[model samples]
Target: MAIKYGRPIELREISRRDGATASPALDLTVRPRRNRKAEWARRMVRENVLTTDDLIWPLFLIDGNGKREQIASMPGVDRLSVDQAVREAERAMKLTIPCIALFPYTDPSLRDEEGTEATNPDNLVCRTVRAIKKEFPDLGILCDVALDPFTSHGHDGLIADGKILNDETVAVLVRQALVQAEAGCDIIAPSDMMDGRVAAIREGLDRTGLLDVQIMAYAAKYASAFYGPFRDAIGSAKTLTGDKRTYQMDSANSDEALREVELDISEGADMVMVKPGMPYLDVVRRVKDTFAMPTFAYQVSGEYAMIAAAAGNGWLDGDRAMMESLLAFKRAGADGVLSYFAPKAAEQLKAQG
Candidate 1:
């Protein structure tokens, strides 16, 4: 509707005589857009900032000599042997990356139904941790304390009669944490999503006098289809015969994620992470706001692959897209991001700086 003053109106004036009492003020006082006019101005007004310091590189370790195996699903990502992994960690150290997360590609021969190899002090994961610490003692080492990578069945925990046993899984996880801690891991990230695992790990660590190790819980990991590429990278795709919906959080629930985070925090998680970063920015924001802890987001395999595939086809600029995607995590209030593109992104950021 149009009013007499030429302004569109949603409500009608009850009486024409009432116009006398109504005064129109046309003061050009506020100009908020002016501050957003220039690059420097926009930067000054920016609410959230992202930096190279906010990145944590995730590396895959394998058992071999002079190996650099490429993961086809995850472009530009490779699985390196322990020596090569240490060299990559050295590069990250020079680039000033605060941390590096290690995920081992367990050989099929080593994986068992119970994932008992996970508790071995000289397992692939523990050996990699020890090697990284020996070479780069000052650098942060985050180990994934989950059994999927080591389990023949490819479930995060022990499965019996078509169901996951929570209490039984926590017991093994405690032993897994102790082994990782003994191998000089700085942080133990329990990505299994098993109930009471964090508390079990905490108690296990304390009893063993490894109380200094930190726990970064994958508190709200969902059973999303986005993990297909990751499964391919870790060679677990063929082993996982069924879905993880019984244990992992449902993709449809947002409030439930907050409750899960709360429980992990109470159970002694030093930090919490929300998986599949791009799809769950809202979850990241909510968790950061609600807990006010060192919240992190995982720029999972699918997020990495999509950008790379598009860039490879000349549909998008790879470097620009990579930086933009990383910056989004920072804008969403992530203290750190676990990304496969960390090295590439960090190199570019260093060059730009």
Candidate 2:
């Protein structure tokens, strides 16, 4: 029988009704906190454990020797020269970081309307890849196959009559992939978001006899404000004329992300990525569930800066927040993450073990 309450019932009154001395008014048979009562218990029941293997350190490259130019917006992150980049790659390898993604901060003189320098074999990115491979041959090197860093207008594709051309840009992207592959890039990540580029790049790679090289397409890259710090890091913030809303996915749509991922997969992308990770974890989960393919996420620059800023102001514990953020990616079913926090997080994990 349900007891209807007109007023609050005392524990003693309930005890009297039950014919007991002092029975409690409320009882919980399941105590969810029991599993969290001890560290050992929590560890044993942890659904996801982040490790060094899940990290891919994204490094910025420039031209020089022993140079490490820091990006103001992204604290603790720097653009390194070829020699410095190789040393950074060696450090990542020592930490057991499986890979490092390279994005070049191309000089202004190299920037042009067609982004022709992207195809140059001795370009900053290609030279960095060659140097890193020479020293750390086993370390996986992911090269960003985009024109934004090389383009004067900072657009990922060619601009024609105030519009970004898709098909024409893809033709150039194919050449860019071939150049990176020729430089021994382990993965050619086309972050351009141009339609049909993956199939074109895959074909280009195959014809060039670079079959072993992989393509990790940025399938669900969104035009979000989260990319601001990244633009600053790559020195593209100043040159960008207009937004990339025409090509990049809208932040409002989730279904569209699925379609993008599906198309990329069908077009021969060996792996797919969701950019600006934390905000789109749902997209990540959905893509992983739908395809069961190798899925990765970029913990983009803005996300790192926010955490760092808060920590610097003493509002949050930096180390704890960093670990939690990375682990959240694992819990959301990310196979791996491209993070600026990679080296620091890896060191923390190593220290913990």
For residue 150, model 1's alpha carbon misses the true position, in angstroms, by: 1.0
TM-score top scorer: 2
RMSD of each: 7.2, 5.0
Candidate 1 local lDDT, residue 291: 95
Q: How many clashing pairs in candidate 2?
A: 0
What's model 2's TM-score? 0.93
Question: Model 2 segments beyond 4 Å from truth?
Answer: 1-25
Output the TM-score of candidate 1.
0.91
Residue 281: error of model 2 in Å? 0.7
Could you give candidate 2's per-residue lDDT for residues 23-88 as a string of tens digits?
A: 435576786877997899999898889999999999998888899998998989999999999889
In Å, residue 352's CA in model 1 sits off its true spot by 2.2
**Which pairs clash in the backbone of model 2?**
none
Q: Please list the residue runs of candidate 1 whose C-alpha ends up more than 4 Å from where it truly belongs after superposition.
A: 1-33
